[model samples]
Target: MKLATISVGGRPTPAVALGSGRFVDLSREGGLPSTLLGLVRGWDAHRGAVERLVAAGTAEIGPEGVRVLAPIPRPERNIMCVGKNYYDHAHEFHGSGFDSSGGAQAVPEVPVIFTKAPSAVIGPGEPIPAWRDPTGTLDYEVELAVVIGRGGSGISKADAYGHVFGYTILNDATARALQRKHQQWFLGKSIDGFCPMGPAIVTADEIPDVAAMRVSTRVNGELRQDARVADLIFDIPTLIETISALVTLEPGDIIATGTPAGVGLGFDPPKYLKPGDVVTLEITGLGTLENPVGGRPA
Candidate 1:
C-alpha cells in the first residue's frame, strides 16, 4: 500500500493511494490511527483495517483540493545519512577535493554515517532554499531513503529487511562550501529545506527486490544521476547492521542510503543550483519527488 500524509480542510490527514492521483483519507475512517507515523507504529494491528478500507474504496477523493505532504512531515530525530556509499560517488567526491572525512581511500572500510537535522525536511513540490548557501554552491544528491518500521538495537544484517516498513525518495541537498569549511557534513547538510522527500511511501511488501530498483535524478529535463540500487557499495543490510549496532532504530526513523555519482561537484565546471532550477528525483516503486530552487537575491 502507498501511504501518504495530505492536507484536507487545512489539517494534515493520513491517506492511502487508490492510484491515478486518488487517495482514501484514513483519518475519516474511525478506529484507525490518525497519522502515518501512528499507523506505521501499529502496522501489524492496523494493516487489515487499512487494507479493508482500500478495498472498500468509498469516499475516495481526487487530487483537486488535497495537497500531498511528506509521509513523515517532521521526523522525531535527526535523519541518519550515509555519505559516499556508491563507489563512483565515493571516488568522485574524493577527487572533488571537498571530502573532509579523510582517508586517501575512495571507498570507506565501513559506512560513513552522519545526520541531517529534522528541521531540514520538506515535502514534495516545495521549494529548496538554495539562497541559504552564502557561498552559492547548492548541490543535489538523490538517494533512496529507508523508513524503519520495527524499532531495535543490535539488529543483524540477516534481520534487517524484517524491520523495514517502506521506502521513499530523499534529496540530500547540500552546500559545497559549507561542507568544505566544516570538514564534516552535519552543518552543510542540515540547512532548512535542504531535505526534500516523498510523494508517498510504498510499503516494503510491494517491493519484491530492493536491489533491482533504479534511482535517478534529473535537473530540469536533463538526467544527471542514474544508477541501480544494486550498485550500492554498502548495501541496505550492511548499513542497517552498522547503524543499529550503535543507535536504536525506531518506526518512522529514516536512513538515506547515499547517492550515486554525477552530483554537481563531480562535474568539471560544477553545476550548482540557482533560483528557478527544478530537481526531480525518482526511485522505481517509490514515487518521484520534485522541488524547485527558490529564495533568489535581488
Candidate 2:
C-alpha cells in the first residue's frame, strides 16, 4: 500500500493513495497523523491493520482536499546516503575534478556512506533553494530510498529485504563546489532544502521485485541521469549488511541506494542547475519527484 502524510482539515493525517491523484484520510477526526516515523515504530504490531484498511477501500480524502507532506516530514535522524555506488556515476564525478578520492575507478570494496541532516528534507514539488552560495554548483542525484521497518544491527543480506517497510524517490540535490572545498560531503550535501523526498512511501508488500527498477533524473525537461537499480555495484543487501555491522539500522532510517550516471557533472562542460530550472527525479513505482530551482532569498 502507498502511505503518505497529508494535511486535511487543518491537521496532518495518515493517508493511503487512491491512485487518481487522491488519498484516503486515515486519521481520526480533528487530529494530526501519527507521523510516518511513528507508524513505522509500531509497524510490527500494526502492519496487518494498515493493510486491512487499504484492502477495504476505507479512504476519505482526495488531492484537492489536503496538503501532502514528505512521508516522513521530520526524520528522527540523519538520512543514510550511499556514494559512488554506481560505476558510471563514480567515473563521471571523478572526471568532474570535484572528486577527492583519486578517481571514481577507486570503487570501494565497501559502500561509501554519508549522512544528510534531517532538516534538509523537503516534500515533493517543493522549491530547491539556491542556498545563498552563488559560486556554488548545484546538481541532482535521483535515488531509490529504502525506509527501514524493524531496527536492528548486524543484519545479513539474505534478510535485509525483510527489514524494509517501503520505498520512495529522493533528489539528493547537491552543491558541488563546497563538497570539494570542505573535503567532506556533509557541508555541501547537508544544506537546508537539499533533500527532496516523497510523493508516498509504497510499502514493501507492494513492491516484490525491487531491484530491477529503473532510476532517472531530468532537468528542465531534459533527461540527465538514467540507470537500472540492478546496476548498483554493491546492491542493497550488501549495503545493509555492511552498515548494520557497524551501527544499528533503526526504523525510519532511510538508505539512499545511490544515483546512476548522467548527472550534470557527467557532461564535458559540466551543466549546473540555475534559477527557474525544474528538476524531476523518478524511480520505478515510487513516482516522480519534481522541484523548481529558486534563487537565494534576497
Candidate 3:
C-alpha cells in the first residue's frame, strides 16, 4: 500500500492512500505507536499494523492535490549516495580525476560513496535554496534511492534484499567547482536544500523489480537525465551488503544509487541551476519529487 506523511490542520501526521483519491490518518489508530524510524526499526513487527490499518478501512484518502510532506522528515542521519555506478557515467568522468581514467578509466572494484547532510533534505514541493556562490554552477543528478526497512550490520549480499523497506527518488544537487576545489564531494553536496526526496515511500511488496525501473530528470519541463536502474554496476543488494559491512544500516536510512549519464556537467558547455529553475525527479514506480530553485531565505 502507498503511505505518506501529510499535514492537515497544521499537525503533521502519517497517512495511507485509499482508492478514489482518499487518505486515512494512521495516527488516528493510536498514533503510529512509535516514531517513523521506530516503525522501520521494528518493521517486521509493525508491518502487520500498517496492513491491518489499511485493511480495516481506517485510512482517509483525499484529493491528489492535498499537500504531501517528506515521508520521513528529519531522519536521524545524513543520506548516503553512491557515485559513478553506471558504465557510461564512469566513462564520462573517466579522466576528470573523480573517475579512474579521469575520463577513460575502468570501473572501480567497489562503489564510491558519499553523504549528504540531513540538513540538506527538502520535502516534495519544497523550495531548493540557490547557493550564494557566484560561480552559478548548480547541477542535478537524478537517482533511484533505496530505503532501509530494517536495521542490520554486516548484512550479506545474499541476504540484503530482506533489509530493504522500499524505494524513492533523489535529486543529488551539486556545486561542481566546490567539488573540484576541495578534492572532496561532501562540501559540494551538503548545501542546505540540495537533497529533494519523496512524495511517499512505496513499500517493498509493491515494487517487485527494483532493477528494471526507468529513472529520469526534468529541469523546468526539459528532460535532462534519462536511464534505467538496470544500468547500475553495483545493484541494490550489493550496495546494501557493502555499506552494511562498514556501518549499521538503520531503518529510514536512504541510499541513493548513482545517477546515469546526461548530467549537465557532462555537457560541453555545462549547464547549471539558477534561481527560478524547477527540477523534477521521477522513478518508474516511485512518485515524482519537484523543487524550485531560489536564493537563501531573506
Candidate 3, residue 270: the lDDT equals: 73
Candidate lDDT scores, in order, read 0.93, 0.84, 0.80
Best candidate per lDDT, number?
Answer: 1
lDDT: the better of candidates 2 and 3: 2
Query: Which of candidates 1 and 2 reaches a greater TM-score?
Result: 1
TM-score of each: 0.98, 0.94, 0.91
- Candidate 3, residues 123-177, lDDT tens digits: the string is 8888877765456678889988888987799999889988888887888888877
RMSD of each: 1.1, 2.0, 2.4
Clashes of 3: 19
Worst 10 residues of 2 by lDDT: 24-33
Q: Model 2: clashing residue pairs?
A: none
Q: For residues 1-298, could you state the per-residue lDDT of candidate 1 as single tens digits?
A: 8999999977998999777889999986788988899999999999999888888888589988898998999999899999989999999999999999888998999999999999999999999999888999999999999999998999999999999999999999999999999999999999999999999989999999999999999999899999999999999999999999999999999999999999999988999988999999999999789999998647
Worst 10 residues of 3 by lDDT: 96-105
Q: Order the numbered candidates by TM-score, best leading.
A: 1, 2, 3
lDDT score for candidate 2 against the true structure: 0.84
